[model samples]
Target chain A: MAIAQAPPRERARPARAPRTPYVLIAPAVIAMLAFLVYPMASVVYYSLQHYNVSKPWDNAFAGLDNFRTLLFDDPLFWQSLAFSAKWVVTEVALQLVFGLALALIVNETFIGRAVSRALVFSPWAVSGVLTTGIWVLLYNPTTGVSRYLADLGLMNYGAAPLANPDTVFWAAVLAELWRGVPFFAILLLADLQTVSRDLYEAASVDGASRLRRFLHITLPHLKDAIILSTLLRAVWEFNNVDLLYTLTGGGPAHQTTTLPLYVATTAAQSHNFGYGSALTTAAFLILTFFSIAYLRLSKFGAR
Target chain B: MMTTQTTGRTLDRPALPEPVRLPRRRHRRRSAQRVARWQIYVPLGLYLLFTLVPFYWMLVFAVRPRGSDSLLPWPITLENFDTVWNGLGFGIFFQNSLMVGVASLIATTVIALSGGYALARYNFRGRQLFMIAMLCTQFIPGAMMLIPLFEIFRTLGLVNTLWSLVIAETVFQLPLSLILISGFIRNIPMELEEAAWVDGCSRLRGFFAVVLPMLRPALVAVGSFAFIHSWNNFLFALMFVSEQEKFTVPVGLAYTLGEFSVDFGALAAGGVVAALPVVLVFAVIQRYLVQGMSAGAVKG
Candidate 1:
């Protein structure tokens, strides 16, 4: 099932000409080069220069000054990086636990399983701003769930979770989890369906308890999927700007700003392309290193 | 020898006749069934609430009149929808989003199809490098690319145009779509195309005749993914297209969210407009989503 496995040599190969494959892939190759590669290269290049759209008179090559400033002078950099790490870990870990549970629960034979799965997974289709919109309506202090609950004598009258620094983190986390868990559930459920029923039956025949069967059979089988999904999700959560941007606007004194959000504000609002590029390069390095280390440490696909 | 024979006979006998052992096993089985039922229903019920509540809240706000405080959306009003669609310029945003989504879908699918075909069938030079490059692109943050991409679009005079968003969306989408489509192409055994070619059809003709039909599910999965992503994309549309008429659903919805005095009803209505197409597409393709992930992403 590994993608790196060589294509079967026995199948009669068509389109064997040297030029044909290149021709077929030209559009994709050209597009990536133009957009992805070129912009990435330019980001690194700009990181070394003093490029600000607002102040052309001061524009010049700054060498490592931007990085130096980011490494030393910028407290917000450290704060946002710390927040990004916290955000990724908490979000990914919670999403995995709940997602795995959701997948397992739905994997069971139940009535209305199809509709249940659809209803549960519907949030995965929602966009970040849309998620923000839905959650905003839910979190509004005057007219939202809090007020409704207050009407029922369940709790207080005003609970502005998004505005309060203490509750904003979890508030955002919950909104994200509403959409995030379904992704892991979908991927893990797909892999779950492929597990051999015979293995479970054998475990049962051996007088193994349900927990033991799950521990011995299902967990081992889902190892690769769990690793892959968590890694992808961690990266996604780290890079994701839309939900946090629209939901909180990195508010309450920059309590919710991720690194990428910081970069966006720097570039789009401040027009500080040079420093923004520096931040972008740092993020790229961190992500690349983290991904490599994760794959290595997890022993991905070792089984 | 007599004791062993008795034990063997007991083992061979149907458990139904062994009243002492039967009840215990049946009891355990029944309890296990009960536990399983509760385990499935209780958590699923709770999670369903968590999932559906926000959507229900949005629906409530969208339908309820502005001044009403009723929990239920009684005396339903289309006023919010009318307000956002007509007044807040979501109609134009909706049209723009549709244009970008459809264009991105077509562009991503067509390009990824060709590129995916190459990867699936042809073991060309740089194939491994190309695959690795595609994988590496996953880590490239779209938010990070805003500055350089803005510059590129400015250089090409594409800034503030829908084409800029279209191109940006297509480029961002190409890598994953290519990988997924290529994985799908590999799953369709190469023999099918060879069989078509054996009937005097050229490679292109063979692909159209034999392979194209079977790729419906894959194309649907990839195209809809592209469409949904493009439609939902905020930063690119935000940075690339600033014109009011060129605003996509996300950008427009973001503006509504960013307003000084928030309009809850209008915002929810706009949210509905933003959500409808993607949610409909998702429901139609929800069945294929897991299958697609297994075939194209996880297994690949």
Candidate 2:
């Protein structure tokens, strides 16, 4: 029934003018041009110059010099890039696993479904800084959960996860997972609701176990949604600088900085527009490359 | 509109039952469904603890007397709220945030509605290209855009103004909202608009009289999305607004967080302020979330 929503090509001889679409699209197009497109073009332009805000005299075209320094000499650049990869992989994988489980559980026709769904999905609304704020209170050594546990004779009191380089990654991961899982759960649940109950009914009659039914039927049905959401989540986790920036300040010694965090710190603090722009361009290219290959390898939407 | 398509009932039964014992088997399946209640609830209960504790912790810190380390909030004080609101300048920040959030909500929704109408209804030149361009923008890391966006805003003398935040938020919000809203407008059967036209309503009048009413859920979904995103936008607000008076909630929270001797009370209080509007918005529009998401999911 809903497939009837496809645009009716046969009704093309309409009373509407062709310009109506353009007119409707004008505001959006103009905004994107002025803000998104123009700024993007200028990022490429700035990457070629030495335009630090502190030194106007140094503002000259540097060609590939910025990229050269980034590729060859910058240890922090490579470190941050590697961390970004690790961060994205860990966040996306964990979020999907837990999120899928949560989505499946909530998809059942159980008691208190509405209220439970609302409670579980609540974290998706919390912003990154707010997330950091909440977790900071939880992770603050003296005033945090560990102190309580220690006072109850459960563990040592002075172990602050965010202050330690070894545990900081997982510390940030858990906090991010709180918010990230709900996004996948919501998307997967939407896709889950569309799976025809008759398919399950037929499988049940065929004496298929629940596990086999999920493997054979539900998995294939959710294939597209899973792929699409995971890809989007991967990119989002890569770009999200708010939580780490606020929580760790990208440090207890630069152990937690993602590439974008580096770019933001560079741009905001050191006023290194040219080098930051170069890093920005590199990150954009990497994302675009990774996305194209990921989509291609996954054979997304082909069915 | 979508709910009608999901529910199954006896009216859908064929002239002959698909299998002779189908009714009996369905009852067995219903009993089987009853068997898994604990499987659903026990783990859900644990996960809910994981989810709700952080929220509860924030509330506890925000209201508990400043030096009392009591686990459960009792004999709550308004001191933290007062500190962040009046003493810490969040009162000004909240006003700024609301102004930015609402302005961008209006801007993003109005522009997206029009652009979405085009994408949904009238196929035209460069339509596919436009859609592709919008999708590609998703991969452009927003954090990376700080340098160039700052440059553009500086050029326009808008670096410290709230308008810079509004414009940046609206632009980023546009791509997804446009696609989602277009997907929604597509799902509203064009026949409804055509029928209105046949009844002597002009196209615009037909849209207002018929289609717009049906679009309430989608509009709310899209509008609230814009509002939530704008409100939560941290980096742009932080980067653009250096003046404390111009700060949004996130920037204020970031400063509160950055201090070595962080005021847990004030930080938690500010966290509550940041969380309040979006949570309320989420609560209201969440019923439509699955439906709204499914439309976009089906499209792309």
Clashes of each: 0, 0
Q: RMSD, model 2, all Cα superposed?
A: 5.0
Residue A288 lDDT in model 1?
A: 90
Candidate 1 per-residue C-alpha lDDT over A46-91 given as tens digits, one digit per residue, 9 for 90 to 100 = 9999999999898999999999999999999999999999999999
User: What is candidate 2's lDDT per residue for B1-300, written digit by digit as tens?
Assistant: 112221143335455356446876654445346335689889999999999989999999999996898989898999999999999999999999999999999999999988987888875778878888988999989988888888789989999999999999999999888888787777778888888889999878987898788777677878888898889999999888898889999999989998879999999999999999899889878889877887653434
For model 1, how does the per-residue alpha-carbon lDDT over B81-190 read when each residue is reduced to its tens digit?
Answer: 99999999999999999999999999999999999988888787798899889889999988989999988999999998999999999999998898888888888877
After superposition, which runs of candidate 1 have C-alpha atoms over 4 Å from their true positions? A14-16, B1-35
List candidate 2 segments past 4 Å from native. A1-6, A13-16, B1-35, B298-300
Docking class of 2: medium
TM-score of chain A of 2: 0.96
Q: For candidate 2, write residues A1-303 as lDDT tens digits.
A: 122244454373255576787988999999999999998999999998898999888899999999999999999999999999999999999999999999999988877999999889989988999999999899989778899999999999798999888899899999999999999999999888888778877786676777888899888998888998999999999998999988888997899999999999999889989999999999999999999899899988777
DockQ of all predictions against the true structure, Cα-based: 0.55, 0.51
